[model samples]
Target: MKLKQAVTGMAVLACMSTAAHAQSAGTFFFSTGWFHLAPQSSSDPLTVTSIGGSPTNITEANTGASLSSADTIGFTGGYFITDHIATEFVIGVPPTFDLEGSGSLEQFGKLGQAKQWSPTLLFKYYFNAPTASFRPYLGLGVSRVSFTDAKITNSNFEANVLHGPTSVSTDSSWVPVFNAGFTYAFDQHWFAGVSISYLPLSTTAKLNSTSTTVVGTLNIQSQTKIKLNPIVTYANVGYRF
Candidate 1:
């Protein structure tokens, strides 16, 4: 009876070991969740003027634009090449961001809006055994931030400031991203995670204006450098396959 019981106990242990390995090494994962972008933003001195009009300089003390926080549905796909190393691609449904004038341009209010698509590629290293229920990871990545569909929203800004019809646009660029996160495994195939990432991003906003009046014509072109260094956060549930 003792010999039979020993054989059964070894069989159960072997099954448990297999279950633990199923979550790591050579696994593929997919996740979907909430992603939020909170911009800690600022801008350089703004110098603008209209042709045949007075020029105004908005200094560092007076140059400010506040970006509203935005959220969207986020998705990620990952492949584990080893027990501790993985590669991931993160993407999301584009989100619209509202820009409000602050400091010198505070009176303008709701200056404009733009749509953003930011996609990232990451290399991550997890710091725990494959069987552990919890793992913490650190990642380094690069992101492509593209801004499109920009529109000027404030009427007064156009009539009073630009003196006529105006067109606005933003430049797109790439930036580095740093990530720190943790994952909690619920079972062999199910897990949940939360991550925080920082991106130091910068862009330029350009405006072109033209007015035809009794006094011939007036035209103006202006550019403003904006720093949109943002902290991005994510909360997700995933399946390991």
Candidate 2:
């Protein structure tokens, strides 16, 4: 009779184990969340490379800039390659960032504004058993970064310093991302997670302005290099299928 009771207890434990299993191979999942970006930013001195289609050497003092923090909605989708390995695609609505003058230019307060787009692909390794309610992960990834709608917003700075109405452009590039996070499974199909990532990124902003000077019509071109190594955070809730 004791042997029969032992067998029954073992069967019950097996059933419990199966019930606790949440993530597994070949499963597809999606998540939506809050995303925040804070830039550790700096810039090179603003330099004029050309004036009226001719090369010139001119730089502005304290004209380097810094980016303010931004927030947006974030999304992620992935498929489990194995019980411990997954690949995810992450993206968000392009967030608008404010630019403020730095160094000698700090007194001006506001400098400009731009919108950023960075979509990422990550290979993540999850730790702990699939049946465990909580799991932590580390990810390595690449993000394609770009900017748009860049413009000088301050009137005094634009007219006096730039010499005319100025239009702006920017260069884009790809960068490496380092990520770490944890997820807690509320049930077999529902989970919540939080992650933080760092990106070492930089870009160049090109400026073009047209002015009717005493010398005649002049086209001025200038540029600056900005290093925007950012720390990003995401908090999410997900569902597994």
- The clash count for each model shown is 0, 0
In candidate 2, stretches whose alpha carbon ends up further than 4 angstroms from where it belongs are 1-21
User: Across residues 128-180, which tens digit of lDDT does each residue of candidate 2 receive?
Assistant: 88878889999999999999999999987788778788999999998999999
Which predicted model would earn the best lDDT? 2
- Weakest 10 consecutive residues, lDDT, candidate 1? 51-60
Point out where model 1 deviates above 4 Å. 1-16, 49-61
* TM-score of candidate 1 on Cα atoms, chains taken together: 0.89
lDDT against the true structure, per candidate, is 0.84, 0.91
Top candidate by TM-score:
2
TM-score of 2: 0.92
Pairs with backbone N, CA or C atoms under 3 Å apart (clashes), candidate 1: none
Q: Write the per-residue lDDT of candidate 1 for residues 38-110, one digit (tens) a residue.
A: 9888776555633456564433357567788899999999988888999999998998888888887788888
